[model samples]
Target chain A: MSVHLLYAFAGAGVFTIGLFGMVFMVHLLRKLLAFNLMGSGTFLVLVGLAQHRNGVDPVPQALVLTGIVVAIAATALALVLIRRYFHLTGQVTLEPGSRDDEGHS
Target chain B: MTSWLLDGLVVFMLLATAVSVLASRSLFRAVVMFIAFGMLMALAWVRLQAPDIALAEAAIGAGLTGVLLLDAVAHFRRGPDKERGGAS
Candidate 1:
């Protein structure tokens, strides 16, 4: 098998593993980490697919670049929310009853 | 020389990184492993002939994401619920 194809397969496998980890892990931080892994895996696949006879496709590379920016923005927002939730409830895990409304009523 | 062998080694490293990322005990360790994974992924991109992706991955995937994760870990560590660090 060509090296490029191998990278594609391995990336897909890691992507799946990371997806499973994100879904099963109870910790929010771990979930976030898993999500990053999945994103990297997707990037790897895109890179592999972009490889061509003379050169790689610039289109997929551009898309992947955009994806990385979006991922970082989303991650920053999520981290802010996690911090706010912790300050409000003093708990890492978000409990349904721990909402701000419960404190007032 | 067998060139395919080196490719196989890269695949093994990628798989190992995936496992470490999922199985790491400490949140910090997991995040670090993820950064390593991104670096390896960039190498894979270069191997695949996508220099643009290699540059993007090195910058945004590894650099920006690493900063974001470190900030998150710090945010969580400073919470009032220090007693419940392992509540997860």
Candidate 2:
């Protein structure tokens, strides 16, 4: 198979793994990591698909660059939120078990 | 040819590390594996003919994310909140 074809399947596999982690992981940070993995998988597919007969199209490259910047900013914001949550509640995870506490309040 | 062989190896490494990252119990080990996964993904990007993505994956995905995770881990170890379940 060609390079694009190989990476396309790889991209799908990565995406699936990331999706599973995101759904099953309870930790906020792990979820964020999984989210990043998912995004990277999508980038791979986009770039892989952009390959034309002779060369790669530039649009997807530009989109990926934009995605990278966006991903970083999002990660920073997410980390900050996690820090804030810890500072406020002393909890690593916002467990559903804590809803009783919320209900009492 | 060497090209296909190398590509296969890279893909294998990428998927393997990804699985390890998810399966690892220790938060630190998982993060470390994640960084390695990102590097392998960067290599895959290069192989797929996307140098710009490779650069971004290395810098943003691997480098920045790794530092961020390490900071979180350090804070987790020493901070007042303490470790709860689901750290891994």
TM-score of each: 0.81, 0.87
User: What are the per-residue Cα lDDT tens digits for candidate 2 across B1-88?
Assistant: 8998998898888788888878887777888989998899889878877788788888887889889888876665555344453443
lDDT of each: 0.73, 0.78
The C-alpha stretches of model 2 lying farther than 4 A from their native spots are A52-54, A97-105, B81-88
Name the best candidate (by TM-score): 2
Q: Chain A only: TM-score of every candidate?
A: 0.79, 0.85
Docking class of 1: acceptable
How big an interface RMSD has model 1? 5.3
| Candidate closest to the true structure, highest lDDT | 2
lDDT of 1 at B45: 73
lDDT of 2 by residue, A1-105 (tens): 577777777888888889999998877777887888888778877877667334677778789889988988998899989978867776667795432111111
TM-score of model 2 (first chain only): 0.85
